[model samples]
Target: MKALVFDKSGLDNLRVREVPTPLLGPHDVLVKVKLAGVNPIDYAVVQLIPVQPMPHIPGAEVYGEVEDVGEHVKGVKKGDRVVVYNRLFDGSCDICLSGREMVCRNGGIMSVVTNGGFAEYMAVPEKNLVKVDLPPELSASLPVAALTSYHALKEAEVKPLDYVVVFGASGNTGAFAIQLAKKMGARVIAVSSKPWVAEFSDHVVGYDQVQDKVREITMGRMADVVINSVGNAVWESSLKVLGVGGRLVFFGGLTGSQVNLDLSTVYGKHQKIIGTTGGTRKELLELTELCKDCRVRVWRILPLEQGREALEWVAKGKDGRIFLKP
Candidate 1:
């Protein structure tokens, strides 16, 4: 099997190499990889994180077909199309029992701490796989981005008629956040530095306002809910745009995480700050259904062999997801 292996050195440490197929357990499913979603963490694992052993495959979200399944796996069978919930959690953990497996204490992320999806074959726990009716036209890129965005909005508890502002709306997670927030009946205010991003929305480029033009549109009111994925670059601005008692959902810190914040605003405004990661299996399933119904649009696909290229493009901060077809 051909897999992408990362060493702590740098890009030179990344290479396509032959590796043995993963061994499966009774409660696991062997998936023939079709597409692997390239995330920032993929590159981070290669450059920043300590090498897992000597070689590690870095990928989290994967969409593919089930080649075989363990006897205990009832949700899917051979030839079934599926999406995986990247969080690997112990079923007995307190968080898992309460259906909050994303925060499971004992579970570790597959690619980060274990073998991930960037390979010809990978074995995953049956509970982590969500069976979906894969549409021929819908590629892997859509599900991964949509699922993450869906989960982020769900965590924020976005409501109808709410003023929802999404920072970095052109990026993978932000794009989905914009559409999902709009679908939920919230008046979406998508913030992005990209000039053409607003074309995706029915509301034109100056239809509402750009990030710099926000003050004119909001008239000093601020948004009711702000979905921020850009880390330090927009953290202060995002915080400044929140109305009193509003909520802010933090998903990723793409630029840099460290930031200085004024504590008085949080206490004085009674605002809420929520942190979220990946989505649940059920949420991924719902996201797939939405895509199948043509409610969501997936924009791009790239082969797994070109994983490095995909990672580079994402690092450039492009809009939409880049799927690696394994």
Candidate 2:
């Protein structure tokens, strides 16, 4: 099988070459890749995450069809079109049994902890796959971005009439945040580049004018729920504009991970600083249902061979999500 494999961690190290197909296990399913979502984290996986063996394939979210199923697999079968949950866990663990599989101590993201779907074929655990009635394009992008945004909103406990501000709204997860917040009847303030804006957001502001515009729109109330993925870049501004008793959810660190935190402000304002990773399998299912026919704009689509170039482009930043068609 032809795949984008990296013997070392870096974009320059990535190469498309022939590799042996993955063998299926009794509790695993073999999927023939269709469309795979290329996240900035994919580059991190290739560059930073350590794997015992060399030649790692880095595609975190995949939408594919079942080429084969393991003997122990049930509730799904051959030829089933599915989405990979991307997180693997030991089912007997305390967190897994409590249904918070996203944070399972024994689990890690598929592409980072193991070889992911940057190839023609890959094998995944049966429990990590979810069936979705979606087109191949949506099947790829929605699993990660939509799932993460949905879970973040759920975690923030957004309610109707709440003022939701999404930083990096033009990016993958942020775009979904705009749509989902609006769908749930919240007034959405999207902070993005001047030329970029999603049709669903109630208000749009560029990074330069985020705080001012948000204050104007909310009449000094500021944001009730603020979702931020960009780290230090939006850190101060997000905190400045958040209303009293507000919530700020942090998941991605696309800008830079390290940042300064003010304990006094947090306590005085009674604000909540929530951190989340990926979405649960249950939330992925719900996200798919809510996103049915929902318009999600793709920045670009490249073939598997262009994986290296795709990583480079993603690094420079983009108006929306990018995916790989395998």
Candidate 3:
């Protein structure tokens, strides 16, 4: 099988090369890759995450068809269209039993700790596959961005008529945040560089004008929740927009991770800062249903051979999703 594999710790090290097809265990399913979502985190996986034993394949979001299944795979069979649940977990663990498999102590993320689906064929456990009714393109786009956005909003406890401000509102997770907030009955204030977010948000403002716009829209009460998926670049601004006792939910940190937190302001305002990453398998299923009719902008769909270029395009910060057609 041909795949985008990186042998060392740099984007420059990534290349398309022939590798052995993954052998399935008794409980694994072999998937023929159809479309794999390209995330900025893929680069981070290659550059920082300790992808053990070298020659690592780094694709975190996958949508594909089951070409074959291990003997023990009971729920799905050959020819099933599915999306990969990128988190690895032992189903019998306490965390898994409690439905918080995303943070299982014994589990790790796909593409980071194990080889992922940027290839012609990949083998995953049966529990990690979710059958979907959407097209390959849309299904491929959801596993990372949409799932993360949906979980963050749930964690923030957004309510009807609440004021929700989303930083990076035009980016991957941010775009989903805008639509999901409105869907949940919140008045969304989108802070973004592009005007396209205006289609879904109650108010759209640039980062420079976000504070004032949020204040005006909420009539000085400020935002009930702020979703800052952009990270350190918008940390201070995200905090500034939240009303007293408001919740601030953050997931990815595309703009560097380090940030200065003011202890006094947090204590005095009684603010809650919540941190989350990928969501549970249950949330992923729920998100797919909610976004079934949604169509996201696809900037490009390149062949698997152009994996390096796709990652470069993602690094340049485009406004739409990118996918690899294997």
**TM-scores of the models, in the given order?**
0.90, 0.97, 0.97
Clashes of 1: 1
What's the best-to-worst order under TM-score? Answer: 3, 2, 1
Query: Residue 245 CA error for candidate 1 (Å)?
Result: 1.4
Clash pairs (backbone) in predicted model 1: 304-325
Model 3 residue pairs with clashes: none
Model 1: lDDT equals 0.75
Per-residue lDDT tens digits for candidate 1, residues 1-326, read 88887755476667788999888888999999887777777777766776455678888877789998887888788999877778878878888888877778898777877888888888889988877776633445444567677888888899998878888877777777777787788877777666655654433233233444555556666678888887887888788778888898987777889989888999899999888887776777777766554332344676666777777777776655676666
Instruction: Name the candidate, 1 or 2, with the larger lDDT value.
Output: 2
TM-score, cand. 1: 0.90
Candidate 3 per-residue lDDT over residues 265-303, each given as its tens digit: 988999999998889999989977899876677788999
Model 3, TM vs. native:
0.97
In model 3, which runs have C-alpha deviations exceeding 4 angstroms? none
TM-score: which is higher, 1 or 3? 3
Strongest candidate by lDDT? 3
- Which ten-residue region of model 1 has the weakest summed lDDT? 200-209
lDDT of 2 by residue, 102-218 (tens): 889898888877998889998998988889898777778777888888899989999999999999888778888889888888999988874456577888888887788899999
If both were scored by lDDT, which would come out higher, candidate 1 or candidate 3? Answer: 3
